[model samples]
Target chain A: MSSALVYALTGAALFVLGMAGLILQPHLLRKILAFNIMGSGIFLMLVGVAQRAGTPDPVPQAMVLTGIVVAIAATALALALARQLLDMNGEMRLPEEKTGKDRLDV
Target chain B: MRTLLNVTVLFLASAFGLALGWLILDLPVAAVRLPEQVTAQLEMSGVVHPVTAVLLNFRGYDTLLEIAVLLLALLGILALPRHVSDHQHRPSSANPVLQTLTRVLAPLMLLVAGYVLWAGAHRPGGAFQAGAVLAGAGVLLHLAGLLPAWATPGRTLRAGLAVGLLVFIAVAVALMAQGTLLQYPLSWAGALILMIEASLTLSLGLILAGLYLVLTDSGVQK
Candidate 1:
């Protein structure tokens, strides 16, 4: 097994872990963390793919670098929204039940 | 119904994982042969490897743009409301021991960050990594209450945020006037890379500081 393959497998494991966390965690902050973990996994996979070609592909590395910056920007915005939501609700926890009345209120 | 949804999501995820796994497994075997076109280009360029040339010169545009994105993020953060008062602000939980430790470690962190920036010319260490380290020092100070959140971002801070983008954009435009975008005139690659790396280090550090301040919602003063 090559080192690239190891990197890919590691990335896949991280992605699965992040996906599970996203599904199971109710807190917005934890969900954000899971999303970031998933993103890191994807970026790692991209880097692994880039390494597959004989010569290094600056293209994929560059794209992944761009993606990292964009991901952080989006995460920052999402965090700001989460902060606002917490300010209104007094709790960071997401409500589990959504009744008809809740839908109407929203 | 919820269980069904969960199972479906899992199945799809597994399929995706398997595809990636296959790609990884095939990569080594496929990589053993070089494409004719790539070999031809290598011969023409007289440069054994083109990746380095492309990264530092040919596609330098991408790198410059990446730095710009970071600069824009800093600007956006600065434009945001300084404090969101409604959110509960956590008080400092600094202990004397931690404060003493951070005071000693701060200088060491700064030294390491400088080393990383200098090492970026031909190695793995680069502006982003160095800036993150430097910002870690600032975070430590903030946690120690040595620096307050609202302490004026200081002139140095503002300059740091803008330097990367300004230098990159200026250089790129100058190159464009010479008939190609981001092309460095002969033998200047090292100098250009160093300048870009230095500015990027400052910009990245400022961005990290801004992010910490935004997340903590603390006034800038210590």
Candidate 2:
């Protein structure tokens, strides 16, 4: 009924959509976009929760601000890795030779 | 099976939503009033409301940390090898109409960004939103070939990227020496917010522009 609840529900839906994109899309860039979408959703949810007391909670707001910066940093690192991978191989596809297990070992 | 999964998740989510809606349906609206601690602080400070106070003073440490993270990102991007083989050039075309449009839009966009930065103290507009707009303008310029794509980012770009973090950190250190981690002792809250917003806008714009360049140069077309 409240606007905060509406925002929370919207955020949850966005998070689910983003998660689905992350899982189904194999492209690294798409994955990054999906991850950013998910981050935005979480930020929205936190802000919504902060609105519960009829005033914004500075703690969650501040945390989300920090989260946004960290998300961008992680994204930049991922982009760099993706670029290196592309350079090594002409194809943009993830290497079929290395399984998830191999990546974990490294 | 996929349909079944979708239906199941939707049903469960709806059920939860219904339960939550019912639980809060009868609660007195006044019960949700903002906490006294926030209001008391606002009253005692004789300044703006809780949100502004909290952002600039109460939890300012978090903001400073966020700026540091942004700075780290710029540093990381700068550290990346800035050598792209000239053999891999993509033929870019220039259009006079588009160039003219961009030239006109750039100044207007910059003005809007400034307005957004100034209005952020008590509104929805802020550093992030304004910076995004400014970056959009930069992207347009880049597309129009007004800006060169150097493998090495220029000194001005680097300075713009670091200014927000440096300013924020300097202010935080000053505040720490005065006792509080980021408290604006003299109650120059408006001035402090403006300073942070301006620096943040510049830093964010540069970061976005840098990211755009990296993404475009990566040649990962969708």
Candidate 3:
């Protein structure tokens, strides 16, 4: 209803969407992108709540700022690992994919 | 069976989403819980921007560790084995449009980065934003084939990568010697913050661009 609530709801929806993607996507890179989307959802929620009082909270804002940088660092590391995997196998699927352990059919 | 998993995922996601929507709707909207504390110490923190004060003054140790993490990521990227194709080290060709855009935009990005770094004391910009901008400029020049053949040249690159962490540690050690850790002298907080931020911006930009360069270099087809 309120703009803050709207944004927060949208963030929650994004988190769910990302999580679903993470679970469903078979490609390693897609999983990483889904993880990022999930992270962005959490960030959006933080920023949204900070504005709930009609004025922003600077502490959460600073934390979100730090979170963004840390997210990039982690993403870069993940990407490097993914690239290494691709080099080794010439394909982007996880090892678990071959093992069928990634499947939830059980 | 395939349809069953999809249905399960959608149903579970929707349930969780509903719970979150309820939580958001119920949380008190008018509570100015944290800003009061920030405002009380605003004058003493030496920055008009409360976020900067929190980041560089009150919670500086967090930032120090953050820089360390970034450096660690660069180190990790550097440690990865290079493929044989990587040895070619040829610059990717850029079209005339990209070359001209890089020429015009790179300088402007640098200027904007400096402005953002300086403005953090009183505004929304800070070292993080400035550093990202600087990294963006590097990526642009890199894409345009204007950067050096090697993304990093030996010791200078290593030193630049580690300088921000070193400076941050130096400041903390200096403070610890005076019976405090990461506690900048109140009178010199602004100057100290600016000095630290300048070093951090350089290292972060280098680390980010280095990461990108490594990602591109490992013979991965872009």
Candidate 4:
């Protein structure tokens, strides 16, 4: 019922959703988005915990800020890798096992 | 097998989610967030905003490494094969209204970025927010045809991109003579922090804009 509790639960849900997306999705971009979602969930949890004292604590908030920046940097790097994979194979996902596809076809 | 994997992952995720819910429900909302010493030492941090103080003063080393990480990402992107890095962008001309809006708003964003940089001393604004605004301006200019599709970052741009890290390292090293790393003389803490933030703002803007431009291209420009 409290705002902090609400945010904390939202963060938990987001983490679960993001993890599900990461595990189930095949597309590289979707994986990246899911990873970012997980990062956001962690950040949200940090901020939520920081806010438990009614006034937010500065240290955790500052850590979250640093984390957000780092997450963006990692996302940029991951995206570039995705683009490279696309250029080489013309597919975002690796060859599907169901198709019995091999590296040559990929 | 794939369906089984999916089901297992789902089950695990749900279990984790339940644990988190229970943790949240039991969390103590009332506690002393900061110790007496941390609150007592706040004045020497040279910023009234506690978050800013923690970021720039107490945990500055983390920020320095973070900027380095950003630069590493830029390097990684640039290191990609030429085919991937070199791509065509959108057409030179955009809708007239959009172009007009960009032209009107970009400069205002720059001004706002400056204000954010200055206001970080006392409020919520800081280098990251200001840098993001500047990046927004660059993206706008890119959309408006001010930045050409084939535009390679010039020397000044490259230098600007690295200036923040260089400044941070240099200052940190210089301060080693006085005492601890990144420890500004208490009297000079505010000014040094501002200088570092200013350089960081410029570099972060260019680095982000570079990534945006590279990733958003639609066609081969050359």
Best of the candidates, DockQ = 3
lDDT of 3 by residue, A20-48 (tens): 98887778888888999999889888888
Clashing pairs in 4: B88-B219, B88-B220
Model 3 achieves a DockQ score of 0.60
Per-model TM-score of chain A alone?
0.85, 0.83, 0.87, 0.86
* TM-scores, chain B, all models: 0.77, 0.73, 0.88, 0.89
Q: In angstroms, give how far residue A94 of model 3 lies from its true place.
A: 1.2
lDDT of 4 by residue, B82-176 (tens): 45345344555767888888889998999999999999999999999999999889888888776653235568888998999999999999999
Candidate 3's error at B165, in angstroms? 1.1
Candidate 2 residue-wise lDDT, A1-106, digit = tens: 5687667656766776677666545567777888888888788877775575566665566567667767876798778766766677753447763333322121
Which one wins on lDDT?
A: 3
Candidate 4, residues A52-84, lDDT tens digits: the string is: 546667788889998988898889889878877
Which candidate do you rate higher for TM-score, 1 or 4?
4
In candidate 4, clashing pairs total 2
Model 3 per-residue lDDT tens digits across residues B1-222: 556777899899889988987888787755457888888998888789999999988889889999999988877876876544546555557578888989999999999999999999999998999999999998888888887534344798878888889998998888897786787888998888999999999999888888787667633333
Q: How many backbone clashes does candidate 3 have?
A: 0
Arrange candidates, best TM-score first: 3, 4, 1, 2
Candidates' C-alpha lDDT: 0.68, 0.68, 0.83, 0.81
DockQ of 4: 0.57
Candidate 2 per-residue lDDT over residues B101-188, each given as its tens digit: 9899999999999998777666666777788899889888878867655455668877888898888888877767777677675557
Question: Would you list the clashing residue pairs of candidate 3?
Answer: none
